[model samples]
Target: MTQPLLSERTLLEIAEHEGLVLKAYKDSVGVLTWGFGVTDVSGHKVGRYDTANGGSRSSIERAVEVFEWLLRTKYLPQVIAAFRGRALTEAQLTAALSFHWNTGAIGQADWVQSFLLGRRERAWSEFMNWSKPKEIISRRKAERALFFDGRWSGDGVVMIYDRVNPKEPRNPVWSTGREIDIKDEVRAALRKAGSAR
Candidate 1:
């Protein structure tokens, strides 16, 4: 059987939530991040000093590149493995990917077990267990809606947050007054990524 691939909608939704940060900045709870919530790429952890040496910004195109690479190299494998051998609906796979990308706990999440055991209602409820940090509750709801009802929310635009002080405590980086429709870009990336896989 052919391995399933992520739809463009999933990519857009994830991007919309993560937002686009071309420059490395501290995220909520203060981790060095850039390019749509990326903390690290391959083995290179994002560092505080890295920003000073021309690491300040990335283009939207480069952000898409990093996002696609991470999806292919890191996140997708974890999702596929967590599901064991069971088939997943596109919606289920998308929801799982978004949740795992944010939380990195898919392999041990109770919702995965609840889903596999056919306790879907319980699965939906338990999925909310990851809603710490509190800011992610809406995202959790959106993921659950996608998983259970196949509802796709969010406009296709990825908002660009302003660059923040690397030394300051975490604050909401205001939108840099820029947004991009990454729908086509994501679709193209997904096609190439799927082929490369």
Candidate 2:
């Protein structure tokens, strides 16, 4: 059987939560991140060296390009494997992918076990357990809503935050506060960059 692909709406959902940053910055935990919350690219952990000589900055198009690549090559596969061959609805897959992308705990997440056991209510409740750091509660709530309610919110508009000094502090995302519905731009960029799959 062919693997299912994430819907555009689903992609936008994840992107909105992750937000967009065209430059490398350290995340809440001080891990170097770039282009839609990516911490690593091709196994190279994003580092301060990446910021040297303005090497870390990228166009929005390029940022989308890299984000899509990570989703396709890394996060998607991990989510798929976590499912262990069980079929899932688009909403379920979307929620799972978003959850896994953010937390990287899909394989051991208690929510997955609840879901597999047909206790969807428990699954939704358990999903909230991953919410730590306090700031992540909103994302967990969104993912939970998507999983159980099939409600994917967000205007497809994502905030483009300003890059901060890597050593400055943790999770200090200084926003340019610029928001754009990047679906069209990302689609055009992907078309120009070649097939997304």
Candidate 3:
């Protein structure tokens, strides 16, 4: 059976983490951006840029539509190529997609290259090397955890697991209720990939 593409749950998680913006604003690099961190609006008439005000107004529905289209048409293909010949679970694919969306061209990313070469531990550690600001660092940590442990960090907060201070709580809601496990699913995907090989 052919594997499914990205799931709605993963899409929602990405959307929640990316945050929605109805108005176009200048990103850190001064590019006009709108609608869940979308920077390139060449083909779609959804966003317009003004030197004085930044991007034009947009609706959430339009933003979501554009996001989904880009994911399917642009990012998904790139991610597939990056992990070509490997079977990936929904969680694993989504985690890689999230990383690709945040940082362009996973094919050029050193971490991904390391992973493709079977240096699993090296690749996992390289996730932290993409750390930028605190927010991005948290996101990298969460992505790393997802890739390795099959856990998704729902609150966009990264907790440092400490065996010594095991009782120290982080985001209680995320830790207790929102965290999701897909280990069995990932293991099955790996097994399938191995068998295919």
Candidate 4:
């Protein structure tokens, strides 16, 4: 039998998917204050903070809360299921997932999904070549360089609670982890995922 592709869920799990936890206690509103540990703005956090200082009906929740919510309510489960039956690496899936998650297309990024499903790596190249404002946070030049080269990467996108991202909100990411022959993992999780759905 052909090997299976690694499931996105498995990729996250292997990386110890604890969702987002706070690096330190934030303010009260969950809109991100101005302090944090090593993590940057896109960096995930688990504590509270002033999210918007008052805006729309969207409640000011913690960075971690939003991160987890996005992971769940945003259709991450479906994406993970797709990865289960494809020839993708954990890092590739994570990179794309985390990238879209940080951006606002958590469940609506069609190009990303289609590219991955179609196994078109070249088509995915330009994903990192977006405007800096589009990127969630930090080290713009460096981030662009690494993402395009397919080698080297940062700690990925982080959800900094109550803090702005350092380095000017560039793309935060590291080398797609070891490229694994994911066929096996994909096959295994596909049946299981579909059944649950």
Best by lDDT: 1
Error (Å) of candidate 3 at residue 40 is 1.4
lDDT, residue 114, candidate 4: 51
Model 2 clash pairs are none
- Superposed on all Cα atoms, the candidates' RMSDs to the truth, in angstroms, are 2.7, 2.7, 11.9, 11.6
Off by over 4 Å in 1: 41-50, 170-172, 175-177, 194-197
Candidate achieving higher lDDT, 2 or 3: 2
Reference-based lDDT, residue 84, model 4:
54
Cα error, residue 45 of model 3, in Å, equals 6.0
Candidate numbers sorted by TM-score from highest down: 1, 2, 3, 4
Rank candidates, lDDT, best first: 1, 2, 3, 4
Stretches > 4 Å off in candidate 3: 1-4, 41-46, 49-56, 155-197
Q: In model 3, what is the error at residue 87, expressed in angstroms?
A: 0.9
Candidate 1: Cα lDDT at 168 = 65
Q: Give the lDDT of residue 99 in candidate 4.
A: 50
Scored against the true structure, residue 143 in model 4 reaches a CA lDDT of: 31
Worst lDDT run of 10 residues, candidate 3, spans: 157-166
